[model samples]
Target: MEIVEFGSDDSGLVARFVDVSNAVRRHDAPWQHLQTVHAATGMLRHGWDGEPAVPFLATHGGDDVAAGEWHVGNYDNLHIAWLTVDVHPAFRRRGHGTELLEALVDRTRSAGRTSVGGDGWDNELSRSFAARHGFEQKAVEVNRRQLLAEVDPALVDRLHAEAAAVAASYELVRCPARTPDDQLPVMAEMVSAINDAPIDDLDIEDEVFNAERVRAYEEAHAGRGITLHRLVARHRETGELAGQTVIGVDRERPHLGNQHDTSVVRAHRGHRLGLLLKTGMLQWLREVEPQIEEIDTWNAESNNFMIDVNEMLGYRIVGRALAFQKSLA
Candidate 1:
């Protein structure tokens, strides 16, 4: 077996890594959206958007069969090293995955981190691998898919009507792929609402959002051939943003859209803003990107509120992911 660390902007190596990664995704969850080489390259180029990442390649029997990206950041739980690994289906049971994971753990320990964390599809192999390696289940995430073709037109109308009736004191604002300058600060602050989501025992911290970080995301999404559509409910009289939601459609995968984030400020709760924001965004997609066939979202299993909203919007569980962590100390 051979292990090589990828260098910056190495498109060829990144493409190969993506090939192996996507192969794993296809075998594990065919219903999931496929990632393009462009998107993979963008992630490699940014090193997970500048959080310090080291990607590893594993070759067994002289062929690349597995890959892993290990990351750490001061912004997150600094003592934990975040890891993501993908092993081609054909390479499973050959000890390639185990060897590569050991290398990742060794590197994490050398970096002075107290723990290593990762997420994987909640399958027999995934669960057994984590358990064998002494990693404990930290959280579970549901992968929900909404088929746009299955969406009922009448339901759409009803949701829009119901949201409008309750949101009489607020107005909905829609924006294209980029954030406007004036709303940058509010948009940045509004993103913090995601911190309220339950993470269970995962060693994670609330993310810091600011104008620069939001701009970085915009640039990354644009580079990855993804277009972001945003909707925000604004207070009618004060013009303050009461809630916001975003949907992203990748040009490379036109049939798949991603439900990014939807959050209603604490003070704005109970106005059905979550529903109003989501339904309004869905309506916008219906008009502008009618070709989108399905949208996928991940929610913590314990987040009943968002889960209920997704269920009402016709999303159903297609798969699951489990977060696992191992103590290095």
Candidate 2:
């Protein structure tokens, strides 16, 4: 088998990789995974807006075998943003996946990066592959979904009112545009604090969420088809970006139509801005995509605060995953 550098930005290559990756994803993740992949891939390719992305291809027996992707982002450690191998259903036991993975390891060492990162669901093959790669299990990214059709409107309304009453001075807007480019510095610092906010057992090395990375995320992750429903909490007295929550809705969901990211700035933690933004985002979801049956989200397993807010909003844990990693050196 020959391992090669094909690069992730090649549209044809990306499409081909998606063909296999999506197939495996179908067998593994919910339909929303495709949308997230589509969105992230687009961002990852948006003029390299994300961290540097490297793609490697594997081929043998005159057939396309697999591809691996690495994204060098804000983490002090160079991370393997994605790695997927498609052993033709016919080629499963022939050890093609193992060979490609070994090759990826060699490449990482040559590149001078410290580690690799990727997430996988709680499945036997996934867990086994991670273990075989010299990776230890890390945090579980809890995936949750709430069906709009079954939502308790009275409860939602009550929470909405209560959250709003407490956060009365702030206004809600639906796009990242409301977040000014100038405030990128403050936005970066605030997000950095939150990124550095308490989480259990993550090998995070530095607080790297900054202005450039935030905008790069915009160009790379939250692109056009996916709209960012961002509600910023401005200090009533200071008018600074004290708190914010952002949700993403992809019109592409097969059954359930939206997914969201909700966060509240640390300083505004006690004022229930988290509650306000979540309730506001739910309200927006209800009005705009009433057809959307549910929305999914992920949070650190140890994140009691966000998890509690989600629980109050009727979100339930649907599945769990491990973010596995290994040091390159």
Tell me the tens digit of each residue's lDDT in model 2 across 111-203: 666676676778887788889878888777888887777788778888989988877776665655335788788877656546634545656
State the displacement of the C-alpha of residue 175, model 1, in Å, after optimal TM-score superposition.
2.4
lDDT for model 2: 0.66
Deviation (Å) of 182 in candidate 2: 2.6
Number of clashing pairs, model 2?
2
The lDDT per prediction is 0.84, 0.66
* Model 1 stretches with alpha carbons more than 4 Å out: 47-53
Q: Kindly report which residue pairs in candidate 1 clash with one another.
A: none
lDDT of 1: 0.84
TM-score for each model: 0.93, 0.83
Residue 231 miss distance in model 2 (angstroms): 0.8
